[model samples]
Target: MLALPNYPGDGGGLIVDRAADAPRYEYASLNDCPQVHPDSPNEESTCQHALRDCPPEELGPLLRIWRRTVAGDVVLEPWDSKGLTCASDVAPGARPTLTMADLKAQFMRTPWAKPQVSSQPKGNITLVNLTTFYRVDWSTGGFAPGEVDQSVLRGIPVRIRPKLVGFTYVFGDGTTYGPTVSTGGVYPKGDITHVYRERGEFPTRVLTTFGADFSLDGTRWDPIPSTVTVPGPVTTITVREAQAVLVNH
Candidate 1:
């Protein structure tokens, strides 16, 4: 018996049950070609023999789905002779045209390392005055936007870049800051500074949200709906009550 996994998209591929008397389905590997001979590579396997006489249209979907299913685990080179030979029989433009979404999906398969975040204190100490304005050294955050031209399918160059969209700040008090744009405030300058009603130690951290855009065929970049959030280093701030006193020396 043969079946296809219900992939999220239109892509689907054949899952064959090798056991003659029983039926069980498992995710098929790219090298597990049922159509090819097991012992002799050239000899016709049961599946290859069956597909050889089948109509050309029926094979297109199977090939496409098979390509997408194991994309992250495998990299298919352009010089793959057998794959190219089978693909050539399909009509030109019969395969789905790759879009920005598809390109983004493909990019997501790669493992990208997260950038480091730096938090600095502005005042003399982490301590802040409850009655006065509070400030902390601000940074633009890491993973700043930059463009990269990547050679995609058929050697077409794709232009892609990342953008810092917003940030989620946790004050560590009972309250939380926003998906805000301000990069916090420096000493003597309070932009997104906060004042605590009481005094104690508060651990603060920020989660930065980054969005991406890509351009195919070197055209104008179009936004991709997906976004990645990276956590910033945690910073602890202490609030101290200040009092005024007069003395004569």
Candidate 2:
């Protein structure tokens, strides 16, 4: 015999009938939800639920979990996905207090926008005989640089800022490069350039990782100590073989 109590609200539970060699799930008072029974091995009824749309009061321990889950601040279970909450399956007093990291994550609803990358020949065709210089313009996103804001976390006011750290370029040719600096380089000679060995079309991409810092009282800034990486738009380049021939009169 097993029993569990729902958190913040007595609306869910799980009962295991050892004698019956089966498991039973019950949601006590939630939306008149019915008890869940597993019919086959493939069928499982865990406390998984969506919390993004749930009322703030009903979130309980789940609020912290959902916030961390959405921000990629926590290690996700194999089954966790967008708008899905498996933390509900755990009993109360089983969750950790929301840390400064969790607070920052919740504040950022969307990741920092992609760094605007500008380079020569921003299209198909790269000369295999010459080096392709690539440059990135970091001033595309609307986030304020070194900007700070105050917000409340669990009733306590906090300050946070999102800072761009670096960029990683996936050349899409079985090789990758660039956790490079965000500052764009001079034309024909850039710091983030790449070269192709063979002639073929390749899809290239750049991923940017942002680090954050937070302060509890709008004073000393403490690093969140975690970086979030988001993929930028894809740009395809075609490399072709070419040669410069000598001309005679």
TM-score of each: 0.47, 0.52
Model 2 score (lDDT)? 0.50
Q: Which lDDT tens digits does candidate 1 get at residues 75-137?
A: 322212123122323422222433334445645543333332223343423445342233333
Which pairs clash (backbone N, Cα, C closer than 3 Å) in model 2? none
Query: Per-residue CA lDDT of candidate 2, range 218-247, in tens?
Result: 555656545777777777778888876999
Clash totals for all candidate models: 1, 0
Q: Which candidate has the highest lDDT of all? A: 2
Q: In angstroms, give how far residue 203 of model 1 lies from its true place.
A: 1.8
Model 2: runs farther than 4 Å from truth?
1-98, 107-110, 122-124, 139-145, 149-151, 182-184, 243-249
Taken over the whole model, the C-alpha lDDT of each candidate is 0.45, 0.50
